[model samples]
Target: MFKKEITAGAKSKVKSSVQRGIRTKVVETYPLLAPHIDEIIPKKSQLDLLKLPDRVSLYALNNEPLFWQHMDDAIVPHLRVVHQFPHCFSRIGIDRGAIRFVLSGAALMVPGLTSAGGQLPEPEGQLKEGDVAVIMAEGKEEACMVGQLKMGTEDMKEKKKGVAIDGGHCLGDGLWKMSID
Candidate 1:
């Protein structure tokens, strides 16, 4: 599915444009950050994002949690793998809609739970043995799930000796959730 489809100059221009867009969007969304936006730009650089080594890079982006509570259902934001590892798992907590490729492993996500069903949907279908499991976001005190996910255990573990992710089961929507990062 991957193929060369763009020229070097075009690629460079597109990359620069996207970087500027991210900077502008972040600054506008967080006005309080207007003062030091310049300094943050270099750190938030997305250059060679497609060339970065296989791994999930977590950035607080100024000590402020990068995760946001998405409420606009009409807006479905697509999250391509800007960076990732082969067997690595990404523990993403999306308050909004998200989509990613199943790169060998699975992606674990648990949204806030409101009630029994809450905002999240229950697991369904016959999940394959090594099939990637994605736990959608739900309300705070209602989401309940228990399943065996290869990546969860790795994502939860403090450090993986030979593994790249910690595999484990998650209960309620905690402040911080683990993933195959």
Candidate 2:
């Protein structure tokens, strides 16, 4: 949704109760992050809440951004944040050809993911639709996007051609470029 660069409009310290709620939500959404919760968000450290345009809320520790949620949707980790815990989420690799489109903020199509260079979720993994996944592009060391699946792995294989993932935070996109301080 954030196609253009955005600046944090106002900043405020998050209350303990609200911070607890956020922590709960984060753990629920990303169970792998449970063990490192303290490292990511220390109990004694102050968490800053930045209010951005279009009702997007960014949660940051000190000057480092951790995650952001659009409206009341699921929280999406910042690309930089995701880079710190690469194995925490399911991943889908896009072919090099589709890298440009993803960076341009386009919804990822099925072909971009099912092509030879692309890698789909393992069949045994049983990824369901709406599951959050990190988008990695061929030759890239870090994830390029963080989004939700539009279709299940089986359906993506059967259909072969259609939008595969909903747009969320992408490399070089507004969210990725947003400054917290």
The candidate scoring highest on TM-score is 2
Across 121-152, the per-residue lDDT of candidate 1 in tens digits comes to 22332333333333443332221222233333
lDDT of 2 by residue, 142-164 (tens): 99999778788778877899988
In model 1, the worst 10-residue window by lDDT is: 73-82
Regions of model 1 farther than 4 Å from truth: 1-14, 43-181
Worst 10 residues of 2 by lDDT: 121-130
Clash totals for all candidate models:
25, 0
Error of 1 at 66 (Å): 6.4
Error of 2 at 35 (Å): 1.8
